[model samples]
Target chain A: AQRVTQPEKLLSVFKGAPVELKCNYSYSGSPELFWYVQYSRQRLQLLLRHISRESIKGFTADLNKGETSFHLKKPFAQEEDSAMYYCALRDPYSGAGSYQLTFGKGTKLSVIP
Target chain B: DTAVSQTPKYLVTQMGNDKSIKCEQNLGHDTMYWYKQDSKKFLKIMFSYNNKELIINETVPNRFSPKSPDKAHLNLHINSLELGDSAVYFCASSQETENTEAFFGQGTRLTVV
Candidate 1:
């Protein structure tokens, strides 16, 4: 079965410091990856996807096929960056009419000012 | 208007009680899903419905049931809820074709006492 693993349960960083949240996946075939964020008292929302190859909120995640990783990174961590972040893998069975997502235990990022 | 919505943001009930969480999506997406987030912050897929038909049902317990009256509404009815069933339930929707992004509703927090 395909699985996503986020190794960090909590990460605290000073404001303006670089932040990196590690994510690794186990899959036999090409996998689609995404990063979702949930701020305090807000719903979980999509932050970015590997397929889009676009940066959102100064965060970017690159799919590394060799390493089987899609870690989220930001050059400068802001107070607003503190949130629960989840790394998800799209189901391989999603061919045409299916949409299934498997998510990892989230990493709580705390940006201290 | 909210693209995806779920009723009763907070539900507190006792064990062995029956409860239902309602969800509706206005995005016109063909696929809807229910996810459970435990205290450890692990998010897992429980059920999925596409066009009012069950497509993906994870290894969730039989006490948990999902109902979709129409394409845009997917409700979860849990019978004989256990103490372990306490978690935040999230509803999400995505376009069934060529779409990897999913929009999630504000989650319903279920607390089984």
Candidate 2:
């Protein structure tokens, strides 16, 4: 079974500090990883995807197939960056073959100004 | 305009009552999904539909049925809801192609007392 693991339940960082939210996955085939963010009282939205290899809102994640990790990182955290972050993995080989996404227990990020 | 939207941002109902949450997406994506966020903030896929066809149905109870009337709308109906069903339900849509990000709706908070 494909699984996504986000170890931290909560993370606090001061404004301008670096932030790293760890994510690991257990999947056999080539994986597609994504980071989704949900702000307070707002809908969840896609922050970035590993396959794109492009940074969004100063956040970037690299897929490490050997380690089975795709950690989200930002050089400078802002107060507005505080939100719930979820790491998801797409399973293309499910019984339905619909490419369902398996998300991790989200990590709440608190940026103190 | 909201790309993906779910009705009844908050729902409070009795344990035995039945309720339905409606979702619609104007993104014109081919795939739509229902995800549940538990008390621990763990997100999991409950169902997936592509072009109004059932594609992925997770190990959810039969009481939980997803109906997609058209390509743009997917509704989730829960029968004899239990207290354990108290959680936030999200509606999301995405293109079936690779590297495309899924768009999500502001979740519906369902409290089954």
Chain B structural similarity (TM-score) per candidate: 0.94, 0.95
Model 1 reaches an interface RMSD of: 2.0
Q: Clash pairs of candidate 1?
A: none
lDDT of 1: 0.90
On residues A1-107, what C-alpha lDDT tens digit does candidate 2 reach at each position?
A: 78899999999999999999999999999888899999999988999999899999999999999999999999999999999999999876553437678899999
TM-score for candidate 2, residues paired by index = 0.95
List candidate 2 stretches off by more than 4 Å: A93-97, B52-58
Task: Pull out the clashing pairs in model 2.
Answer: none
Instruction: DockQ for candidate 2, please give it.
Output: 0.65
Residue A10's C-alpha lDDT in candidate 1? 98
Report the C-alpha lDDT of model 1 over A39-71, residue by residue, as the tens digit. 999999999999899999999999999999999
Give candidate 1's TM-score. 0.96
Q: On a 0 to 1 DockQ scale, where is model 1?
A: 0.67
**Could you tell me how far off, in angstroms, the CA of residue B87 lies in candidate 2 after the best superposition?**
0.7
- Writing each residue's lDDT as its tens digit, candidate 2 over B20-61 gives 999999999888999999988888889888853586454799
